[model samples]
Target: MRPDSAVSVPDMPAIDLQDVSKTYGSVVALDQVSLRVEAGEWLAVMGPSGSGKTTLVNLAGCLDTPSSGSVWVDGVDVSSFSRRELARFRAEKIGFIFQQFHLVPYLTALENILLAQYFHSLADAAEAMAALERVGMAHRARHLPGQLSGGEQQRVSIARALINDPAIILADEPTGNLDERNEEAVMELLRAAHQAGKTLVMVTHDPTIARYADRRIQLHHGRITDISIFSEDDEREFDQILSKLWTLRENHEPLHDDSLRIAGPLSVGRAIAAMTARGWLCRENGRITLLPPGEKRASDLIRRHRLTELLFSHTFELRNEAELEDQAFKFEHSLSPEATARICAFLGHPRACPHGSPIPQGDCCPAAS
Candidate 1:
């Protein structure tokens, strides 16, 4: 929805910061920051705590103005807007999703969404309910924020953010308070919004979460230190190598330098050395073993692989062992933890795959007996 409050200037970026700096007395939050968020682009801002990630999002959302230079949103110079104008402009053009799930304590789920609609334009009950339904939260429309689970509350917050049909969605650590399943649910909604042409500027501390964006920027002491664009081939190679190591460990087989099984099309020796350098695994006394962090990552990947096997077996009724293994290998890396959980739940949380191998328990699985 185009906001009437701000006139669109031709050839201007969707969200732009020109040499912006923000300070609080003796402390500097952002220094000489210049950023441009293109229309329909997803940009991730990543940094450690006290690294000015939040400050950058706040400026883009128009929640706070820059101490120097200018901040512009939707081609308008928001830095020059009056307080009332800024509020109106933000309401119409920007939607915010906070990590804290900032729903009003006293308001019910539906009511909270209506509040956002009230701010943006006329509050229509039908539209608000539709928004909740989109996020699969319509059944709990009457529940208050206090009565909902963390995931439920976040879903309600998402509904509220989209109620206005804003062009830009600013999210700050949106999945910070969620578990694996809930985080997947929240990301699915955000991905849908991005697909619908909403520009997303999200601040995150998790590398996995940051990978969802088109580009990622790292902040250090209020300065943009690095920018990264992802390559799919790099990720695929890493997953393939890790999976081979995981299989060896799970089968109680030693990963000796002469283990030809692990040496596939890729240079297995170099891959193992790289993983060891990254602290994902260790090579000692001519044997290789996974470190704690690497074990967990490999476990998740294996879980996804077995779950995919189960899904394919049931859906396609395929009984060929080679076919199932081939399909599972190709599809496993594409499944998110959340999607794997759903597949597991759909299959009644089976403990074993079609080949009778025990499936690894995911976070969404019930406790083992």
Candidate 2:
């Protein structure tokens, strides 16, 4: 898609690559690639080991710059930003989550998170606590990085990232060092943050994990080679959820909070509360209603969530429903409405979710455009 044609054109993209090309002598690290990611979207950059994934992340995170073309973040073309401006932008709007869990061994988790605040004018203990709480790491706030497990350390890293309240998070192989269980745990935290409206971009070789992204773009020879949308599994899952919602709607059955799972890091109750506060919904007893009576918003949320899970399962070849379901739940909510719609369309308007239920239509997907 043309950069200008992206949804909400004037809105500063969380990250934008315009004909960006990187080369070292005869070796092309990336070639004239263009892409746009809106605020609050999770995009996975995937490719073989040397496919320029890290190069792209470095450029987007402001750690480096493109050899050609332009890179924009939050609407500012940062290709020519002064050194001070680059440092300020990186501190204010971008957070990096490294695979190595680069926490100070001696500092407590709280202190590590607080370290990021030193660059800013406002710093408070409450903000630190809230960041910890957001990552389910509040209980471990006082623990040193050495005392925590790999997963726990990653969580601390995430909490640190949150202290900045950045619009975009750049993670590089965040789960690479952990075992299966730990990997899942770290991913859960990342997913949850994404759902809460943070913009996230991660580099991973694992397709399963990549599936958690609203859009997966592959880089080869330093150029974008493919962009994968939602797949069959995604459609199946959407159909299942839609069926359930429709059943409840038709029977006039109270839409029990327990019956609906938002497929996000936050619980259904939390999701409902947030959406209601934003005027997206209204709830009375067991029944929840879309406040504006618009199907599009609801569909957008559902489709994004389902497609995220589907991508995880398909990319990773994960066959366990419980595993896939857990991953999907956190991923879906991390997507922007525009990215969500693209995923839904890519999946061919799947009638059911992976678990076998109808997928509800949303405003994001217009009727036969």
Candidate 3:
């Protein structure tokens, strides 16, 4: 049997990949990639589909082996590990969050977490329940994956991942399948994990989501292309607040503490305070109103939202109203002005959304069209 105990090394990087490549038949999945992730660092890997983002993650997490070079974790060359050893190493040292959640369909939330423990060590029901409680899913612990909502299932998946107290987390588009509200909730959980000093490596397509990491790297055709360090910013929070304000304006609702329902990581009061400080909005006579800059930003955001709705409804042929709305909400914050303009033009400068409401005119719309 392989060594049952993991040798601990002082001040070692959490993950290190040197000149690693992977090929499936004639197709090269990853091309000579080299990366190092420090302990407690949060790193974002981004690229388009088939760009080797997931492949790189799979190699680092020991879900797959590299075709060449070294794969090291906790200062040990995992490349030399047998399949069984790799499985044990993964259970002991890594936590994973995925877009699809991947919970056992027949298992209750609590049981799923316990299953993870069963693999690493002995199962403990109390510890499992506590893990669920941490993600606000303890009440749903008895429910099976099919009975839980998308967000709840993801919460359960997270609890299971963290139940082992793994040193590293590998999240592949963790929020991809979630709606805006759920996306925010899930991201908040990830932020908590990062703050607690877990080494995080996440694969995401959204720039806003990637900005959450300490640093982000771009991959292209299986090669590293660009790497950027994150700059602290409140742009995401501002966008969300502005989106909420725009909806209130559309519905002719007053912007008050009770009326405003801002979702995501930021609390309602904190979001409002930040907006007030940024001169995006103001409060007088116990009423809040958007300033010019705020108004412009909100209008643009609304335009993007409606455009996204159109893109889904008309282009993608999505028929479910709820799904369309959810997708539109998720995409609005990420769509670039250039892409929005191209979409507007592609749709023949449509004047109305699918719901018979006027789509706010973009600059790309022809005059008098």
Better of 1 and 2 by lDDT: 1
**Candidate 1: tens digits of C-alpha lDDT, residues 182-290:** 9989998999999988889999876567778988888889999877664675456656666777777668887765663443434667656645544467888978777
lDDT of 2 by residue, 117-146 (tens): 777545678888888888789999999998
| Ranked candidates (lDDT, high to low) | 3, 1, 2
**How does each model score on TM-score?**
0.75, 0.60, 0.65
Clashing pairs in 1: none
Better of 2 and 3 by TM-score: 3
Q: What does the lDDT come to for candidate 2?
A: 0.75
User: lDDT tens digits, residues 104-154, model 3?
Assistant: 999999999999999989899998999999999999999999999999999
Best by TM-score: 1
> Distance (Å) between predicted and true CA of 333, model 3?
15
lDDT of each: 0.84, 0.75, 0.85
Q: Pick the candidate with the highest lDDT.
A: 3
